[model samples]
Target chain A: MTAQPDHPDAKAGHTLISVDAMGGDEGPAAVVAGCALSAQANPDIGFILHGPQEQLDPLIAKHRELAGRCDVHHATEVVTMDDKPSQVVRTGKNTSMWSAIESVRSGEAAVAVSCGNTGALMAMSMIRLRKLPGVNRPAIAVLYPSSNPQGFNVMLDVGADVRADADDLLRFALMGTSYARNGMDLQRPRVGLLNVGTEEHKGRTELKEAYDLIRAQGESTGFDFVGFVEGGDISGNRADVIVTDGFTGNVAIKTGEGTASMIGNRLREAFKYSPLSRLASLLAYTSLRRLSKKIDPRRVNGGVFLGLNGTVVKSHGSADATGISAAIKLAAQLSENKFNDKLAARVAATLPAEESPS
Target chain B: MTAQPDHPDAKAGHTLISVDAMGGDEGPAAVVAGCALSAQANPDIGFILHGPQEQLDPLIAKHRELAGRCDVHHATEVVTMDDKPSQVVRTGKNTSMWSAIESVRSGEAAVAVSCGNTGALMAMSMIRLRKLPGVNRPAIAVLYPSSNPQGFNVMLDVGADVRADADDLLRFALMGTSYARNGMDLQRPRVGLLNVGTEEHKGRTELKEAYDLIRAQGESTGFDFVGFVEGGDISGNRADVIVTDGFTGNVAIKTGEGTASMIGNRLREAFKYSPLSRLASLLAYTSLRRLSKKIDPRRVNGGVFLGLNGTVVKSHGSADATGISAAIKLAAQLSENKFNDKLAARVAATLPAEESPS
Candidate 1:
């Protein structure tokens, strides 16, 4: 439930978000700190923190900002980063990840935020929340820093289901465009199906099929299908939304992040190479800091679970306080907008035309 | 046809690299200029330039350095970048791209360098040179700048074919390692299979099967298989070689390039933001140039066609003189090392195990 809606037209609801306090690589302390930061910023914001009471209670107590805003849900078990998804799903009923999602399922919380492993988190979320009707494969959508005026492009499935056929890809396109509109607020978003080439005849068979399917829905779905975008276009200004199977999307995003990180490190090394260069760096300090902040990974930290019955934001497992807070901000924004409700409607609206392969 | 060998023990072979002086976005002048630069640096380098006789003749004659080194091959037809690969392979025999590959097929040129489109070039290379025995899918391998001491990592199947099966992935692994050895001079390269996640249980089924197949061959193949690697690992120092199907590999490499390009633009923008920052940029010019040169896309300009009977280097279609020179440098180096002969042997050695999935 989102209490304070950013949009005047958004329906009023509670602003409390469910969060898994354990399972993050930085542990419960970072999560508590992030929650406190969120609580301090929005007086309406609250969190149902799930973890062992002993571990989370003291962490919350130290953060005075979280004094009355945190509700400790006693989940005695924890899902380790290395736990297998299948293993966790069967035996993880009492795990913090499961309990966090349970709050969303039981309608006690509007959204669930976790820094646990992606596979396990998805496994737990899907089982607890279930897929929206007519949704074949749920997808994980993440915002990528790009050349857009909005400063980022939406890409999915980062890793929900690795394989997506023609129909599934069409569904991804529908869901992704809806996300660009509701989440990023890009009205009439231009969507592109990711491929090796921009040519219609290139790529695999399913891609060609998906190309037609996506193009056919361009007018009716209320988004322009910028047919067949290449990998460079993922960050290029060609399209606002890039839709692909989970496997390719996941690799593209990671590769982009890696390149940015390496360049960032190299940028610092260049400034430190000589005394004059370091002195010049001091002069250019403000501009460089702005550039760094513009590209910082923490500023764009959440991966939204789409086509699900409830909203779940999977933060990076190694996220520190800043990254966790960024994720919480995204979760709250989506919850406040009733993003899941709209995403489900968008998918259901497109399903009647598709012959469900599943 | 034998020219000077960079390695004394390397088998002697002709260093005459065939050139397709047409179909590039920049046209024939750039191709002739690139050849002139290559000829200027290496007395052993000669070009069998292919294009319409009238168009290429004047361009070659204008370049004084190309006077004796350039041989213009007459071809009335050209392969436009927009021409479909399927159509080219059938009706493109007279096209400059096809004629260039023909030189390699006839052993008139030790290797061929093309500034033509990638899909057409790969199609021409595969059809003219043909896949090596026991190889089902031929791959394109490119050297990507990375955190390694060698300064680059080899990633394959960038876009040769859109799909690769488990066995084809194993071939890519073998071809990639062989590429690292001969192309980059890494004796025992650490290879990784790109996936959505590093976990063995993660990714599509084909990837899991590829993990085992590649791991099994690591001992005999002389490269360390570093299990499953994510998109970030493509640039990270976790491995020396990254292998995947053309679909994922293409997206990964393009995404990386796009990101690097975006950051490069942003870096320029950041420095130009204010008068002080611009003045600081002048003070730090040399250091910034070094960083720019380190990450410049032009320096690493060639994409090698692997799993073929003869070695082929596909130059970037938009390559200028400097970029073209880099592609020629790579082509000359591969020929000097007798890389194609070794690559053929490497694939031949692995086929006994694949059961000929083709």
Candidate 2:
């Protein structure tokens, strides 16, 4: 993999992932564990754990094997979960989340990873790092589990643009398509608008507008427009790429995550209910394991914030070392490929020269 | 359970159910199975299955043990999945779907259930049954599995009203509250509006508008308005009932369903990957069985269409006999309780008598 030539610091040929140690529910424990795990697994990946020195020191000391290799950018404050996204930049000026995001904006880090409040992280990324040219909105792209044996499906705009217009959705489709091609290595991704039904006129006013815009783009948009996709469509890989507004996307993603956990808990509950189910669980062992790998959260931990000037990955707030390790690996790949720049350039080429501004 | 004395059809005494035999992917089979299962369970629950006689005969015959128990009304034609809701009602006069709906309008059936094209069903229900006296728009209500071991969460308007206003949401809240009270048998159901955040001013325009309207009703409305809830709020059963527009609610429910299945499939895949997991699955047999039951679709097969004059349940089109059975059971319980009448009266009492109309 090679970074895009247009990337500001692509010629430096180095990968430094800034970790927001103050982010996530479990705080520094999970963040420290994840950073150490990533460092141990990938010798080439470097980390900058950003947080208050006093708070981060003990955790770093516990993982001395990674101490000599990792760097810490001491940040005094933290961004609380309840804080509004608009207030994140102002109130937590010295917070690790802000600094980590700034690190990427300044080319000090290849990517910034946070498990903090998604809205704050998104706000910081958009305001500080800024969006790539030709992209009106930067989307939170998620790789959802597909029923297909091939691989996962990618969708974007998962809560960044709540009141998204038709043009915004059109831009999201373009960005998602590029992300799939550049990030997931798909040649030409199939894109679809999330709707109540497949019919063009079946959606709400906003969705109807999006349907028309997407349809008007035609084959010239690069990605294959697969028409409208319903909620059930996500079960099967109906489209390689799906685009929806952030509110729906966020709800959908969280629902997916929560449902996964809920199902696991339910499965456990079922197995414990009676001796018959216990025996059934035993009989279904082989098939069950196969199913787990297909929908494992660890395997799908990293969520790329697309349409940004630089690549940024957000891991699950409740993620463990294994999940974090996967996130780092994903970030490393994004960095090496300079995925963001390629996506930006592709979007730019599609827009009129007079309308394109970089 | 006995019918409400105040209910208009209380004198009739009989619990009449209208089954759309032509609805569902498998047509009469699903509806017939549902009716048979429901009839066998509740001797007082009567069904009017509307469809072609030849097709309905075998389905009803399969449940011949309940021979004198059920009736099948012959409506020769059927509605195609792709047919527009407007087109179906305007042209398909003798269609099974329309005939089934007509049974409810004619006061022959206390309740109706369908698994056909959702749009067509909703359109027919609103047009024929009409919204309850004070209701402006009817909403689809669904039960979402919560992390709480006790019960699943109830969400209203999963896709019935696309352009719902503040007044429409208030009506949904009133309807949903009755569902929890009469249907789920909860006292003073905790109501909530699904939002991006818990803050009053945080959500989009429509949500904010709904929030203000719900707040204005306050405690006097006979509903315990529990304030705002996020997507994650559903997991913990933070509120007994949650309200949102049809578009978001539908996407949320479907997303949850797809995710639970995906995760279950993933776990199955994992167990088969190696001997260790296979052994683990066996040792964890009791846990696995419990989990299956926790996420079982049969347990939450039907979604009630709230704010209508009659109790109507819409099951998944692809639901099997067990799922259909559950839907039928839900329909019977709802009809016996006169859920809609209670909701409408409560809403009407809360609003000025003259201002109740849309």
CAPRI grade of model 2: acceptable
The list of candidate 2 runs beyond 4 A from truth reads A1-12, A64-68, A216-218, A274-294, A353-358, B1-12, B148-150, B267-294, B353-358
* Model 1 CA deviation exceeding 4 Å by range: A1-14, A353-358, B1-14, B353-358
Instruction: Report per-candidate TM-score of chain A alone.
Output: 0.94, 0.89
In candidate 2, position A90 carries an lDDT of 73
For each of the candidates, what fraction of the native contacts does it recover?
0.89, 0.52
Expressed as tens digits, the lDDT of each residue in A76-163 for candidate 2 is 9888778888877778779999888888988888688888877788888887877777677778888888875447788777777676
Poorest 10 consecutive residues of model 2 chain A by lDDT?
A: A1-10
lDDT of 2 by residue, B33-109 (tens): 76777777787766777888888888787885446555677899887788898887678778888888887878788
Lowest lDDT block of 10, candidate 2 chain B? B2-11
DockQ (CA atoms), all models: 0.81, 0.44
Q: Candidate 1 docking category?
A: high
Q: Superposing every Cα of model 2 onto the true structure, what RMSD results?
A: 4.6
CA lDDT of B13 in candidate 2? Answer: 62
Model 1 residue A37 distance off true place after TM-score fit, in angstroms: 2.5
